[model samples]
Target: MRIVVAHNRYREAQPSGENTIVDAEMAQLTAAGVEVLPFIRSSDEIPTMPTTAKALLPISPIYAPRAQQELSRLLTEHRPDVLHLHNPYPLLSPWVVRTAHRHGVPVVQTVHNYRQVCSSGLYFRDGMICQDCRGRALGVPAIVHRCYRGSRAQSALMATTLAVHRGTWKSVDRFIALTTAVADHLRDYGIPDERIVVKPNAVPDPGPPAPLGDGFLFMGRLTPEKGLDLLLEAWRRHPVGALGPLRVAGDGELRPMVEAAAAERPDVSYLGQLDRAGVRAAIEASAVVLATSTWHDVLPTVIIEALASGRPVLGTALGGIPYLVGAGTPREPAGTGPASVASAVRGDGAATLPVGVVAGEAGWVVSPDPAALAAALPVARTGAAALAPAARARYERTFHPDVVTKQLIDIYADAARTAPRH
Candidate 1:
């Protein structure tokens, strides 16, 4: 039951669902009587790193010798049964996987995004979904486009890191995919079907559904990829009218746009980024949650959090979203059927499907187009109250922390069995 939980925290400037998931899982495991040995690195520390350490950041992704040495020491000291890795970019490298394996500790990594194939890890570019580097041996598209942080050098470095350590990723005893789509993406990258497991991230339940408050809730990083613009356009086309105001939480590159829209329209209010409790309160108060991301998001936790709070989501039918919102059933492993083949041929870009409006529960799934989003907005206004119970039901059945934690325990046990006997 003892494990080393390793993760590299993303920069604190932007809210990170991956970071949220890691913290929640660690807390849940400890509460469940499992011992967690944390091995963590923070992007916040990068700016404060000494001059020599700053120089080391470039090689950190490729192979951080010091990180490997420290991890080796941790393995020798703790003798953990399993090493569970979340994000291993910039600070901790794939060397940790090799280090864990060398020390007889099985490694279990969570595939949080499309980082294995796309340099930005977002599978996005130029305000649109892009997947030009998939299955490519060299990842030249990322280099050509400067996808990561808009720096060719950084993007090239990430691409090189992926190329150099493709085998190191395969060395993992298990890959925890956040959704069926994520598992399918991993398989598309040549990971074996048996090695990948579908495990969606779950949030701590926010008790019972609060009384329905007002219009809708759109929360998360307010970036282009999040499709905030699309949401605004949809709102412009179809004003909130009788339902109530549309509340937007979080800040990013699109703050001015949000602020301008809020000023121009009384129905749209931009509430700056809210903390965890704030987000929950908003979810509880809102009639529906909005997830308008244009990219193939692995599994936006906001959708699940809303469902957990008994608020249905009106989200894009992209990536793992349709599955997350219960608009569609879980996809089978890749290549299992004709649909799988079609999905593969479609690449990793966000494919807009027809509007799905579920009755009584769940929510609507629409294309990112403003017209499509405009068409689905009323579904939330009309059906969200009735769908509250079903939203909570979905959370309990699939994303309850108790349920997901047990699954984690089983995965850890399976991974531990793969480790060499002491």
Candidate 2:
């Protein structure tokens, strides 16, 4: 099958998991013998654009005439069977859906976030989960609160673009929801069950996973929503050197908090921002990986990375973390001692959620709190060895390119059947 994949990449300095996933998926398709065409744009180009292009940048979110013209030429020349879209923001607008429809091409979009209704696409603002603009036609609340990149003007533009493209998004032939939580979000947005498919992103298999490592690694942006503070508070509850070591990475608004924690505790160390190789090295050296986001994070790639490397994840029970960690599956544990599913018991003797360090299980999914995470830490450390195989097994079954790419190909075939027969 011939497929055209389009995406507007986020800036490189910050890095975007979506960009990484898109590239990985395209490579997976090519390896599987499918013809793939990538149409991509980068936010890094905004700084050195020609005067004419820069002049049209402000309105590009609503309708990028240049993108439409270029896409039209590509589609008309190729006549591809399907058009799959990832992120379409400042340069590649949602109008690309209309362009695909005009060319009689079925459009399949991977819904990455809550952008359809919320201007920020995060449903979070000012360090809190805010959905004030959910039912509004214009999302005036977003503009008032300066939610999009802390600029009222930019928020207004994004909000207006969302309001105008309501039909364009809904009219998509298929929506690839990254997680069950994302699928639920699409349903709440009025997408029918048949039009939405649950397809998680896949990572490359890193060959045989090394033996379980020591300590725990928390990588990603050190922001309020990423829950770096909560992790630290829990770490402080334990005495120094009591629960192995904790390594924190990434830079964000909460860097001071992370640095302070590292300075105050010998067990805690800050590794700053990591390149892909550095991240892999850290994962290999860690017994468990952390995904402690306070917001409704759709999917944190770090959890999957740890799984692929045979490291169990200690994730918060929010958004797709539970699903990513293989929770709610009706499979029995592997063996005795750390192999059984563990319930995080509070210091006060209260029990919280369970950690599945079992046969098909990945790890623990605790409540989004310091206490729950604190209770789960020792359990995760104890079960790291038994959980290592389970983590690797889960990666091979679900997030491996050998598995998810076939599901994607089937989705493309279904989408192609829905294209207009003009």
Candidate 3:
């Protein structure tokens, strides 16, 4: 089957998980001999014109017109069976959806983040979750707070896109949510429940678990929402002997802070930036993967990569992480009820500790607190080795490219078959 994938890349230098997922899916399809075409755009392509021109640009949404015209020509020429979308926010607005509808192609969009409702796209402001716009008319509180572009005008443009297109629900044929929690969030934003489908991002299997070293690892952008500050605080709270060295991967605005912390604390090591292979190597070598983000993150690919590498995760109990981690464990007995006093105590021969168990099985979940993190550090360090087999098994079964590729293809075929026939 022929398919066309469209995505507008993020402006940040760091590659996003959504980009990775799209690339992986395309590769999988091509490997299987399917005709896969990519219609790509980047935020960098947007000319850095004067403030006045830039401000007015959002009105006609020039990016949308250009993308729609380009896509129309492509669709008319190739006539792909399906048009799959990842991100079309600022650079390629709802105009792409309109183009697909006009050409009689099924449009399947993946909700990578909360950008559809929030101008910031993170549901975050002032280093915390801000849902002022959720379940309400598009709010400019984020703009007033200088959420996007740090300018009221630009933020308003972003807010306006959501406000104007709020009623364009019929344009999209299906919405691919990365998690059930993400689907629920979209449903709250008035997206029809029947149109939303849950499809978690998957990663390639990294073979068997390798021998892990003693250091803990941090992978992801060095940003406020990533909870790097909290990670630093937790490290400080731990006694010197109890804390292993921390190796941070990836770069962002918080690079200076990370550099300063690394300089001040001998245990913290900043690895700057690394490519995909480098990231996989780091995950394979580390004891535990640290996902201490303060904001609600929809299923992060790093977590899946870590698990695939047979590395355990110490993530904050927020959003869909608990659910993702739950896939690794065996079901608890039906009548096991709540934990008893004996089960709660660590030394009472209990098969599992309730505090760390997620979905009655997977890796540990600590409160988004420094003290809790400090306490859990030892447990993570100690259990990291033992957890390898189960983690690897989970990756082979769920995230292996062959397994995930088929699921993605099935979705594409279904959308293609059900697309409106012109």
- Model 3 residue-pair collision total: 0
Per-residue lDDT for 1-422 in model 3, tens only? 88898888776586587778788878877987889989987777567755754564566432466667889999999998888888886666777877877888888888888877888888889978898877657676877887877889878887877777776544577888888889988888777877787877777666767787666899888889888998888788776646678889889899999999889888888987898778877886688888888777888888888888888787777676665565222222345422211123333254344442332134666556665566567767877777766667766776678887787788887777775653
Q: Which ten residues in a row have the lowest lDDT in candidate 2?
A: 351-360
Task: Pick the lDDT winner.
Answer: 2
Per-candidate RMSD, Å? 6.0, 5.0, 4.4
lDDT of each: 0.83, 0.85, 0.74
How far does residue 129 in candidate 1 sit from its true spot (Å)?
1.4
Candidate 1 lDDT (Cα, 0 to 1): 0.83
TM-score of each: 0.92, 0.92, 0.89
**Clashing residue pairs in candidate 1 (N, C-alpha, C atoms within 3 angstroms):** none
Pairs in clash, predicted candidate 2: none
314 Cα displacement, candidate 3 (Å): 0.8
Which scores greater on lDDT, model 2 or model 3?
2
User: For residues 1-422, what per-residue lDDT tens digits would candidate 1 score against the true structure?
Assistant: 89999999998887898899999999999998899999999989998989998998998998988788989999999898899999998899988988898888898999988888888988899988898998898899999999988899998899999999988887788999988889889889888888888989889988878887779999999889999988888788764465588999998999999999999988988889899878887877789999989999889999999888888888887888888777652233444431221222112232322233222237767656776577567757877777788889999999999999999999999878764542
lDDT by residue (1-422, candidate 2, tens digit) is: 99999999998877578888999999999999999989999999999999999999989999999999999999999999999999999899999999988999999999888999998888888777888997788999999999888999999999999999999988999999999999999998889999999999999888898777798999997778888877888788888998898999888778898888888989999998888899898999899999888888999988889999999998777788889988742222455232334643432343343433221278877666566577668877887887798899999999999899999999999989864543
Which ranges in model 3 have alpha carbons more than 4 Å from their true place?
A: 47-57, 60-63, 327-360, 419-422
Estimate candidate 2's alpha-carbon lDDT, on a 0 to 1 scale: 0.85
Worst 10 residues of 1 by lDDT: 338-347
